[model samples]
Target: MIAEVMGAICVLIGIPFFLTGTLGLLRLPDIYTRLHALTKADNVGLGFIILGLAIQSGSWLEVARLFLIWFLVLLASATSCHLIAQAAFEKNIKPWTKEE
Candidate 1:
């Protein structure tokens, strides 16, 4: 019961952040900031969903695949985001400024 509830909770929490990441891609200014949101929150949301699914499945193969997918997501997202950020930095793109 508790596991099921936790899985459900994880799904609920993850989906919103996933959506927010997508929305943030549209809402944020600058490619670097957008990349940060797209990579970080999106990867975290994916990890959460994968973790929830693994917990619910409770099968050896399923757990293995879930972990693999999560790691792949982390690796891919991090690499891509790093590339984007580096390119932006090299191009002399400005970071966001506060209103003070």
Candidate 2:
């Protein structure tokens, strides 16, 4: 019972992170800021969701798979974000500023 409640709570909490991340992607200026919002928030959101699912999981294999998926996504997102930002930097893209 406790695990179920906790899992539900975690899932509920995770939803807002995804929403805010999407909002940031739409509202923020510059690629860097958008990437920050996406990577950070989505990572946390997925973490919470995975945690919830793991808690609800009945088998060790399922939990391991969930964790593996999260880890893969984390690595992929971080690498992709870095590559994109670096490319933008090489192209001499300027960050959006308040004055602009």
Candidate 3:
């Protein structure tokens, strides 16, 4: 019962992060800001979801798989975000500032 409750709580908590990231992607002005939101918030949200699933996992193998998936996603998102930002920089794209 306790594990179930915790899992549910974790899932619920993860959802808002997803929503916030979506909103940030839609509402933010620039590639860098959108990338920041998409990468950071989504990664944390995924972590929470993985943790929730791991809490309910039937065996160590399941938990390990979930964590491995999360790690892979983390690396992928970070690398992609960096590559994109570097590309933008090379192209001379400027970030949005408050004065603008």
For model 1, how does the per-residue alpha-carbon lDDT over 16-79 read when each residue is reduced to its tens digit? 8899888999999878778878987888888788878877887899999889988987898889
Q: Write the per-residue lDDT of candidate 2 for residues 1-100, one digit (tens) a residue.
A: 8888998899888999999899999999889999999999999999999999999888999999999999999999999999999999999999888884
Highest TM-score scorer: 3
Worst 10 residues of 2 by lDDT: 91-100
The deviation in Å at residue 76 for candidate 3 is: 0.3
In candidate 3, residue 96 scores what lDDT?
A: 89
Q: Where in model 1 is the C-alpha error above 4 Å?
A: none
| Number of the candidate with higher TM-score, 2 or 3 | 3
CA lDDT, every model vs. true structure: 0.85, 0.94, 0.93
lDDT of 3 by residue, 1-100 (tens): 8898898889889999999999999999999899999999999999999999889778999999999999999999999999999999999999988884
Q: Which stretches of candidate 2 lie over 4 Å from their true place?
A: none
RMSD of 3: 1.0
Candidate 1 TM-score, C-alpha based: 0.85
* Model 3 weakest lDDT span, ten residues long: 91-100
Q: Which stretches of candidate 3 lie above 4 Å from their native place?
A: none
Q: Candidate 3 has what TM-score? A: 0.96
Q: How do the predictions measure up, each by TM-score?
A: 0.85, 0.94, 0.96
